[model samples]
Structures are given as structure tokens and as C-alpha cells.
Target: MKLSLFIFLAAAVLGPELCLATLHNITVKGELLCDNATVSNVKVELREHDTFDPDDTINAVHTDSSGRFEIFGEEDERKLTTFYLRIFHKCDATHPKVCTRATEYDVPEKKLDSVYDMGSISLNLQDNKELGRRYDRDSEECD
Candidate 1:
């Protein structure tokens, strides 16, 4: 009886922690701003990088009135994975970063402990061919 009780107590104490460590619900959140002003109604997407797909995208959440956006995802297949965030909106003509262009945020394996706040990502509304450099490079070569 004593041994069984000890075993039960040990599991009761350690089971939850072990479970929590194995799986994590990594949430990505951030704000979009253009020219120092909050951009609303912008479509923010979460692109996942896994062995099965190059850059599998999901969710098309629009920015709230405060220009904030958020998304939830599971851990990556590899230790170092990328969660690319592409933004789009009607202001494509004004904001070069708009129009489903890739703005990546690498969610490394070590950072997958809990919710990750990407902070305020600002766009200067400038045009540049090298906008999605990281994702572009990975697209050509991601195993």
C-alpha cells in the first residue's frame, strides 16, 4: 500500500509537468504599422515550414482596430523552423510590403516554450525586390 501510494503521488506531481513540456501551443502575435500609424483590416497569414511542405500557409486573420494580429500553431518538425507571416491589404499601392508578400518571423525550437509576442512590426511602405529574402532563399532549398 505504501509503495503504491508513493507511486501515485509521484505521478500526480510530475505528470502535468511532463505533459506540458512535450506539447506546446505556440501563439504568434504582433501589430502592423505603416508610417507610424496603425494599419487596420490587413490580412495576416501564418505560414508553416515542415518536412511535408515547403511553406504551408494557414489562417487569414485580419487586423483589429488597434492593428494587432495573432495566430496559434504547433511545434515544428525540425529544431529550427520558420513561421512566415505574410501581410496583405487594399493599401498595396501605398505599402510595398503589402499584397501577400512574405515578412518572416523565425520561430526557433528553443523559443517554443509558450506564447511569443513578435512585437510591433513596422513597414516603411517602401518597395524592394528583396522583401522576402529569407523565405525566398528557403523556398529554393528547404529540406
Candidate 2:
């Protein structure tokens, strides 16, 4: 009987928070380019930025042979969702120490619930400050 009372109080306290969950959906499409050339097989990941917790990956996909990709994701979040695209490629990887360059692009909140077309994105590491570097375990040298 005591355990049942505890559970009831717990649910009563948390139920409202759970009920406040909202569903957010977004669609993003774009083409990747490197120096006016199409970049295929590049990894594109849709992520939700979090303040206190690790960012969540909504979906991951690779650019097609034409360097175009489309991703759709949905999440049940209690707060407003902030989305971004993380593009992983070796476009400007020149130094042997660098393997892959990760670039980020923020998605505007107005674009939610509708298709956001990024058109053509040319990746230049020097011009982009949102660049991150990491190495591929299989390859020791940059491509």
C-alpha cells in the first residue's frame, strides 16, 4: 500500500511535464560543393543542440552521387528545438595531421515544419569558423 502511494505521487508530479511534450519535425535538403566541384559520399548529420546534455543526432545520411542530400527528422521535446547540420568531409583536408573537417550550419526556427532548401553550400575551411577536425582510424593521411 505504501509503494502504491509513492508511485501515485510520483506520477502526479511528473505527468504534467510529460504532457507538455511537443512534436517537432523538419526537412532539410541541400547540395555540397568543394571549390565548385560536387562532393559525393559526404556524411551529413542532423542534430539537436542541447545546453547541459550531449547533442542528439536526429538523422544521418550521405550525399548522393550528385552531392545532394535530404533528411527529415522528428522529435518529442519539451522545449523549443534548435537544429543544425553537421557536414563531415575531407574537402579542405591538406595537412597530413587532419583527416576530416566537420562544418556546422544552423537551421532557422522559421524553417521548421517546412522544407528548408540550402541550395548550394561551398565548403572552405579557411572561411568557416565552425570547423572541427578529427582523424579517421583507418586512414593516417589526409585525402
Which candidate comes out best when scored by TM-score? 2
Scored against the true structure, residue 26 in model 1 reaches a CA lDDT of: 60
TM-score of each: 0.56, 0.90
lDDT of 1 at 108: 54
lDDT of 1 by residue, 25-45 (tens): 467788888777888877776
- Scanning candidate 1 in windows of ten residues, the lowest lDDT window is 134-143
> Please, what are the lDDT tens digits per residue for candidate 2 over residues 10-59?
99999999999999989999999998998999999999988899999999
What C-alpha lDDT values do all the predictions have?
0.62, 0.87
The positional error of residue 34 in candidate 2, measured at the CA in angstroms, is 0.2
State how far residue 132 of model 2 sits from its true place (Å): 3.7
